[model samples]
Target chain A: EAAVTQSPRNKVAVTGGKVTLSCNQTNNHNNMYWYRQDTGHGLRLIHYSYGAGSTEKGDIPDGYKASRPSQENFSLILELATPSQTSVYFCASGDVGGRAEQFFGPGTRLTVL
Target chain B: EQQVQQSPASLVLQEAENAELQCSFSIFTNQVQWFYQRPGGRLVSLLYNPSGTKQSGRLTSTTVIKERRSSLHISSSQITDSGTYLCAMGRNSNNRIFFGDGTQLVVKP
Candidate 1:
């Protein structure tokens, strides 16, 4: 089975602090995605990358940014964290097209105070 | 525009029972995928039925493209099945999948 691993499984940050969550996927899938999970809202897509050095906005990308420095890694950066950003973050990888199923990472739980 | 939507925001069931979750999409989605997530855990792909019907183990999924809707049926529900079932749909041009809020299922022994 393909494995997607995320670092900083748990993080606590003060408001206005900068935070970065990292994800690494061994599947070598061409598509990667970042999402945040909140109560009642389900999982909202924050950003996605088609490949290395490419990033695109998703439905809720206003408070977040993404970086894909390499094909195996993707990072989510919060310039200035806020309490509203306290949520679980997930990383996923998929095939070249959307038709394929995505493999997800263990996820990171972030708390902004 | 919020293209995809799911029904039964939550569900409670007993062991050995049956459960059905529904999902609807406003846009003309070419593919539909269903995922299951345990509390505080990552999502696992349960089914990826673009259209028609497919079955795996005790889980079955059916998608009606013309109707722009899909359904996931769980047979002999187990306590381990308690979690959230999320439905996502993807179109031809946009490989990004639009997700529904999901249906939280709680199974009691």
Candidate 2:
């Protein structure tokens, strides 16, 4: 089983402020992902990484950046947060190849004021 | 671009009643999965039936790849089963997965 934990379970940020949501997984999976969940929008992938030092843009990557400093860490950064960016964010990891199972984190709720 | 759509945006059920959830995709995919999520809680994978029928406990998932659709059937629903059901499709081996908005379920005892 994958153990995906995220830091700062809750957050509140002002407009134009910078926010960074950190995620850590102990599953040792090769892939990691960041997503935002909103009403009627479900989960939209923002960024993903294959391994350390690798980041790829997902479906909705605007106004967001991702970092994979190590196999156990993946982070989502909002350089200049806005009210429109407020939503619950999730981090996941897994092997999408054979026997695919993508494990999800508890999620981080970010509120941009 | 790929899109996953779940029908009956919301549902209400009584104890011991049966429930069915549907998921349809706009693109062809061999990767299909079902998940359960409690209000403000983490997601729990229910089934990973990509192209066939699979069952786990009282839950059954069937996928028709050619139709790009899948269905999840839960027998004898319980209050503990009240939550949102999500459907997702794996885009690639790198874990590129897309999810539907989800169908919120409320079970009354």
lDDT, candidates in the order shown: 0.90, 0.90
iRMS (Å) per candidate: 1.7, 1.9
Query: What is candidate 2's lDDT per residue for B25-67, written digit by digit as tens?
Result: 9987888889999877888888888898999999999999999
Please write out the lDDT profile of model 1 over residues B1-109, one tens digit for every residue.
7688898989999999999999999977768899999889989988889999999999999998889999999999999999999999876665777789889999999
- List the candidates' TM-scores in order: 0.94, 0.93
lDDT of 1 by residue, A24-110 (tens): 999888889999999877788899999999999998999898999999999999999999999999999987655656778999999
Candidate 2 segments exceeding 4 Å error: A98-100
Q: Which model scores highest in DockQ?
A: 1
For each candidate, give the TM-score of chain B: 0.97, 0.94
For candidate 2, the share of real interface contacts preserved is 0.41
lDDT of 1: 0.90
In angstroms, the error of model 2 at A22 is 0.7
Residue A96, candidate 1: Cα error in Å is 1.5
State candidate 2's TM-score.
0.93
lDDT tens readout by residue for model 2, A30-102: 8999988887677888999989999999988999999999999999999999999999999988864564568
